[model samples]
Structure formats: structure tokens, C-alpha cells
Target: MSTSDWLFLILQFFAFSFLAIGGAMTVASDMHRVIVDDMGLLSNNEFVTAIALGKISPGPNVMFVAVLGYQVGGLFGALVLTLAIILPSTTLAYYVAKWGQFNQHRKWVVAIKAGFTPIVVGLLFSTGWIIVDGFHSMKAWILGTLVMLLVWRTRVHLLILIGLGAILGMLGIV
Candidate 1:
């Protein structure tokens, strides 16, 4: 990639880092737009696979940025995008945590927390919907719905659910 391409990649991730309210997943649709739709850096399948890989990994979901970077460039791209996406958000989270602790009893703080709860929930729902939309099979839809129901109504461990999903995938059931 050229210097300008590298700069744009870094800047785009940096901007998305700040917009990642609730979580990095919250900005996924915008990331899809910029990386796949606008820049054509990755195709639809590539983008969806990146997200799936990131979600299955042990670290933060923001790892999708690293996957995108690697897809666009290489190792350097991965490192640059990961750092760009993390730095601003990590710093802001630290200071905000301090502020929140100090102002825990304030009415505005409580109100802000209350207001953000629904927004975060909605963002999470949207993220799930986006992922689900990528699956083209009715079997996948049924399995996903069953998994969602299990998560909402039962006390089963999440890793077990994930394992079950993986098994289904391996058996070509979903």
C-alpha cells in the first residue's frame, strides 16, 4: 500500500475507535461501509469471515479491525489498525472510569448510565442481526434462533453453546 493508503487506514480506525460506544461491534456497519462498500478493500464474504473469526477468538471483538487491516495490507497493517482502534478508546475509558467513580452519586451520572443502557442493548441487537443476515441458510437461522432461545431461557454455559454450534457446523447441519 502507498503512504496515503496507510494513513487513511490508520485514520479510519482511529475515528471508528471513538465512535465505538458500547463496544467496537457497535460501529461494525460503518466499518463494513467504509472497508467493503466504499473502499472495496474486501469483498462481502471476506468481511463476514473476518467478523466471525474475530468473534470466535479469545480477545476483544475489536480484533476485527486487525483482521481487516491484515486483509488490506499485511502484518504492519494489522498492528497499525489494532493500535489505532485501541489507544483512544482505552485512554478515554480510563479517564471516564475515574470520573464515573468520583461522580457516582450524581443525578446526571445516573441518568446518563440509564440512558445509555437501552442504546447499548440496541446496538448489541443490531450487531447480532447483522451477523445473522449474512447466513444464507434456513438451517443456520433455525440453529441461531435455538441458540438465542437457549441463552435467554436457560443457564447453559456460553462456551458449551459455542461448541455445539461448532459441532453443527462441522457436521454440515448449519
Candidate 2:
């Protein structure tokens, strides 16, 4: 990539870093928007599959952006995507932590923390819908429901559920 291209990618990285409110979900959605919507780097199905793989992988799901970048523009793209997804959060977190400490006993701070609980839950539900909407069929619904129940009812490892889903997928059961 040229210097201009690198600069542009860096700017995009800053934009994503600043805009994402939550953690991985926010970064992942930002990546989806850039790669799928803006760049047209991958098809919708590919985008979803990439995200699923990212989630099941050992590390953070946001690393999927690097994979997409490598596919689209090799090493430079991967570097740009990583910088964009992570840098802002790391920098802002410092300020946020300081602010939280400064306002530790403030009533308004307490109220805001209380308010954020439901907002976070709502975002998580929306993320779930985004994932579930990609699956097409009654069977997918049945399996998803069973997995959801298992997650809710037991302390089962999430990887186990994800593995079962993958196996079912491979068997064409979903």
C-alpha cells in the first residue's frame, strides 16, 4: 500500500475505535460494515462465516478483521485493520478509567452505570439477532434453541456448544 492508502486505513481505524461503544461486538460490527458494506471485500455469506469462525477461534473475534484484510490486501491490510480496531479502545479506556475514578462517588455516575446495564443487554440481544438471522430453516431454529437453553440452564462451556453447532452444520443437520 502507498502512504496515502495507509493513512486512509489509519483514519478508518480511528473512526471505528472512536465509534464503538461496547467491546468485541462493537469492533466486529464495525469490521463487518467496512469490509462488507464499504469495500465489498466479501459476500454476505462469507462475512457471516468469517465472524462465526472468529468467534469459535481461541483469541478475540475482532481478529477476523485481520483475516479479511489479509485476504483483501495482504499484510498491510491486516496491519491496518488491527490498528484501527484496537488502538482507539486502548487509548480511550485510560481516560474512561480516570473519569470513572474521579466520579466514583457521584450520584450521576451511579445513575449512568445503572442505566448502562439495560443498554448493554439490549445490544447483546441485537447481536444475537444478527447472528441468528443468517440461519435459514426450522432446523437451525431448533438447534439454536436447544443450544440457547443449554447455555442458560447449565455451566457448559460455550466452545462445546459452538463445536456441536459446527458438527451439526457439517452433517447438514442445520
Candidate 3:
């Protein structure tokens, strides 16, 4: 790759890592902003579509890093952004683990967890909302509600629901 390509790759990698709060998936919203809004490399609709695809894949939602990288700068960009998306949170989780070991029984630790629980739940809810924004229709709502019920009531694998959704979409039912 050229020097500029390498530079952009490195920058994307670290930027993703820095945004790793409430887990790597939360970084999707920021990445959507970066790719669609700041970089003007993708439209808002494209951003949402890519995020849905990324979430449906077998890995973390941060897979959008690799997808965006591939679109922007080819294979090398994908590799760099994958690393970027992983490295920061891995480091933070490691440190957090270490800290937890040190402060295992601290009341402040319990308080901190209690404080962050709602924020984490809210982030997850927002992630779901952003992912489905492009699928606004009665059919989409019906399928989404069924999927939510499946997720809530049983041990059905998420991949199965995603696959069924894809099949339904192909049939123009979702």
C-alpha cells in the first residue's frame, strides 16, 4: 500500500479502539459517523446497511471496521482496522480485569457497576435501533417482533433467526 493508505489505516484502527465503550459494538455508531458523515465515503443509508451486515456476521459488530477498510483501502485497510477495532478494548478489558482482581470487594466497584448497567442497556437498545432504521415497514416490524419474541422466550440461536430473516427478506415477506 501507499504511505497515505497506511496512515489512514493506522488512524482508523486507533480511532476504533478509542471508541470501545460498552463493548466494541457501540463503536458502530461512531464508525457510521466517520464513514458516512466525516469521510463522506458512504451515505447514511449505506452506513446503516453495513452495520446490519456486520452484526449478522459471526464476529463482533466492529466487523464494520474491516468492511469499511476494504471498501476504502483494500485488504491492508481491512487488516489494520480489524486490529484497531480489537486492540483498544482488549487492552482495557485486561486492565479492568487486573483492577477488579485488586479491588474485588470494594463498595465503589459495586456502585460503579450499578451506575453503568443502565447505560450499557441503553447503548444496546440504541444499537438495535440504528441497525434496523433502514428496515422501516409493517413487514419489518412484524418480523422484528417475532424475532424479539423468539429471542426472549427460548434458547433459539440468533444465527437461526438471522438466517430466517434473510430467507423471509428474500421472499419479500420481511
Candidate 4:
């Protein structure tokens, strides 16, 4: 990639950090739009694969941002994109923590916090939709729905589900 492309990618993620209300996962489709559809850096399969990689890895689900950077530009690209995406959030979180400490008892603050739950849930649903939509098969849809229901309604561990999904994919079951 050229210097301009790197600049654009970094700036886009910096802006996206502010818009990441429920976390970076919520802004995944927008990332997909910019990285895959708009910039044509990665194909749909590549983007979805990156999402899979991110999901299976430990820590924040946003690891795919780094995976994508590495895909596009190698190790340095991974470092740049990870820092670009996280720095804004990290700074905001620090100040928010300080403010939240003082306003923890405020009614409006409680109300705002309560209101965010639903919004975050909705955003996560949309992100799930985007990932599931990539695979155009009934089996994939069924598996996705079943997995989602299991996650939502049961005590099953996420890593187990991920492993099962990987096995199913390998067996061409999804």
C-alpha cells in the first residue's frame, strides 16, 4: 500500500473509534465496507476469514483489525492499525472512568447506562448478521441460529462453540 492508503486507513479507524459505541465489533460492517467493498483490499472471503480469526483468538474481538493490517501490509501494518484503532478508545476510557467515578450515583448516569445495554445488544446482533450473511447456505444459517440461541440461552462455553463450528466447517457441514 502507498503512504496515502495507510494514512486513509489509519484516519478512518481513528474516526471509527468514536463511533464504536458497543465496541469495535459494532462497527464491523463499516470496516468491511471500507476495507473490502470500498478499498478492495481484501475480498469478502478474506474479510470473513479475518473475522473468524479474530473470534477464535483471545482478548478483544477486534483482533481482526490487526489481522487485516497484517494481511495488507505485514507486521508493521498490524502494529499501526492496532494502535490507530485502540488509542482513541483507550484515552476516552481513562477520562470516562474518572468522570464515572464522580457521577456513579447520578440518576441520569444510571439511566444512560441502562439505555446503552439494548443499543449494544442491537449492534451486536447486526454484527452477527453481517458475519452470517457472508455464507449463502441454509446449513450456515441454521448453524448460526442454533449457535446464537445456545450462546444466548445456555451456559455453554464460547470456546466450545467455536471449536464445534470449526469442526463443522472443516466437515463442510456449515
Candidate 5:
């Protein structure tokens, strides 16, 4: 990549980091827009695959950002994007957490927390919608609904669902 491309990548990720109010997952749709639609750095299948890999991985779901960076510009790109996405959020979270803790009893703080709850939930739902929409199949829709219902009603482990989904994918079930 050229110097300009690297700069744009870092700047984009840094901006995205701040917009990740609920979590990195919240900004996933936007990432798809930029990475796949706007920049054409990755195709839809590749984007979905990256997200699946990130979800199946043990650590933070935000690992998809690294996957995107790698797809865009290899190892160094992964490092740059990961740091860019994490650093701002981490720093802001640290200070805000301390402040929230200290002012836990304040009415405004409580109101702020309550106000953000629905927004966060909505953002998360949008993320799910974006991922599921990529499949473009009725079977995928039905399976997703079933999995969601199971997650909501049962004590089944998520990893088991992921494993089942993987098997279904391999068998061309979804």
C-alpha cells in the first residue's frame, strides 16, 4: 500500500474506534460499508467469512477488524488497524469507567446509563441483521431465527451453536 492508503486506513479505524460506543460489534455494519462497499477491499463473502472467524475465535469479537486489515494489507495492516481501533476506545473507556465508578450515585450518570442501553441494543441488532442479510437465503433466515430462539430460551452453549452452524455450512445446509 502507498503512504496515503496507510494513512487513510489508520484514520478511518481511529474514527471508527470512537463510534464503537457499545463495542466493536456495534460498528460492524459501518465497517462492512467502508471495507466492502466503499473501498472494495473485500467482497461480501470475504467480509462475512472474516466476521465468522472473529466470532468463532476465543477472544474479543473485534478480531474481525484485524482480519479486515490483513485482507487489506497483510500483517502490518492488521497491526495498524488493530491498534487504531483499540487505542482510542481503550483510553476513553478507562477514563470513563473511572469517572462512572466515582459518580455511580449521581442521577445524571444513572440517566446516561439508562439512555444508552437501548441504543446499544439497537446497534447490536443491526450488526446481527447485517451479518444475516449477507446470506440472502430463506434457510439462513430460518436457521438464524432458530438459533436466536435457542440462545434466548435455552441454556445451550454458544460454541455448540457455532459448531453446528459450521457443520451445516460444510454440508451446504445454509
Candidate 6:
């Protein structure tokens, strides 16, 4: 990639960092749009693979940003992205959390927390949709829907769900 493209990705990542309400995953769709659709830095499959790699082999799912950076710009890219994703959000969250602890019972604070619930839910849904959006088959749609339902409605273990998915994929069921 050109220096300009690297600069663009870094700047976009920094922007996403602040809006990562629930987590970095919440901003995955935006990342997909900019990185894959708008900038053409990576293909959709590569982007999805970064997410998968982050989730499956991770200290945190947020590490997916590192994968995206690495794909685009190697080790330096990874380090820069790691910082971009963490620094602003971490600093913001730290201050916000401290403020929240002090004002935990205030009406505005309570309202703000309540207000974010639906937003976080919507963001999470969008992120999931972005991941599922890649698969076009009816079977894939069904499986994706089933997983979404399981996640949204039930208390089932995520690992079990992941394992089940892996097994089904191995058997060519989904």
C-alpha cells in the first residue's frame, strides 16, 4: 500500500476507536466498509479472516484490528493499529469509568447508561450481520440465524456453539 493509504487506515482506525461502545467488534462493520469496500485495502474474505483469527487465537477479540493492520502494512502496521485502537479508547474509558463510579446514581448518568443499551445492541447486530453478510447460501443464512438466535435469546455457552459450528462445517452441514 502507498503511504497515503497507510495514513488513511490509521486515521480511520483511530476514529473507530472512540465509537467502539461495547468493544472493537461493535465497529467491525465500519472497518469492513472502509477497509474493504471504500479503500479496497483488503478483500472481504481477508477482513473476515482477520476477525476469525482474532477471535479464535486471542487474548481479546479486539486483536482482529492487528490482523487487518498486519495484512496491510506488516509489523509496523500491527503496532500502529494496536496503539490506535487502544490509546484513545483506553484513555476515554478510564476517565469515563472514573466519572461513572463517582456519579453512578445520578439521573443523567443512569439515563446515559440506559440509552447506550439499545445502541450497543444495534451495533452488535450490525457487526454480526456484517460477518453473516458474506455467506449467500440459504443453509448459511439458516445457520447464521440460528447462531444469532442462540446468542440473543439463550444462555448457552459460546464455546459449545463455536464447537458445534466447527463440527457442522467439518461435516459440510453449514
Which prediction has the highest TM-score against the true structure?
2
Task: Please report, in order, the local distance difference test score of every candidate based on alpha carbons.
Answer: 0.87, 0.76, 0.74, 0.90, 0.89, 0.89
Off by over 4 Å in 2: 22-56
Considering TM-score, which of the candidate structures 1 and 2 is the better prediction for this target?
A: 2
Could you tell me the TM-score of candidate 4?
0.67
Model 6 misplacement above 4 A: 1-13, 19-52, 55-61, 71-76, 122-126, 145-156
lDDT of 1 by residue, 5-108 (tens): 77886788889999987688888898899888988889999989989899889888888878987998889878888899899999999999899989999999
Q: Please give the distance, in angstroms, between residue 6's alpha carbon in candidate 1 and its true position after superposition.
A: 2.9
For candidate 3, the lDDT comes to: 0.74
Over 94-160, each residue of candidate 2 has an lDDT whose tens digit, in order, gives 8988898899899988888888999989988777766776776788778877877888899999988
After superposing candidate 5 on the true structure, give the runs of residues whose Cα lies further than 4 Å from its correct spot.
Answer: 1-12, 21-58, 68-74
Which residue window of length 10 is worst by lDDT in model 2?
Answer: 22-31
Q: For every model shown, what is its TM-score relative to the native structure?
A: 0.72, 0.76, 0.72, 0.67, 0.69, 0.63
Off by over 4 Å in 1: 2-5, 25-49, 133-138
Scanning candidate 6 in windows of ten residues, the lowest lDDT window is 127-136
TM-score of 6: 0.63
Candidates' RMSD to native: 3.4, 3.6, 3.7, 4.0, 4.0, 4.6
Model 6 has an lDDT value of 0.89
- Pick out the ten consecutive residues of candidate 4 with the lowest summed lDDT: 17-26
Q: Give the alpha carbon lDDT tens digit for every residue of 1-174 in model 4.
A: 899999999999998888997678779899999999899999999888888899878888989999988888899989998998899998999999889879988998888888889988887798889889888888989999999899889999998998998999899877
Better candidate number, 4 or 5, judged by lDDT: 4
Question: Which residue pairs come into collision in candidate 1?
Answer: none
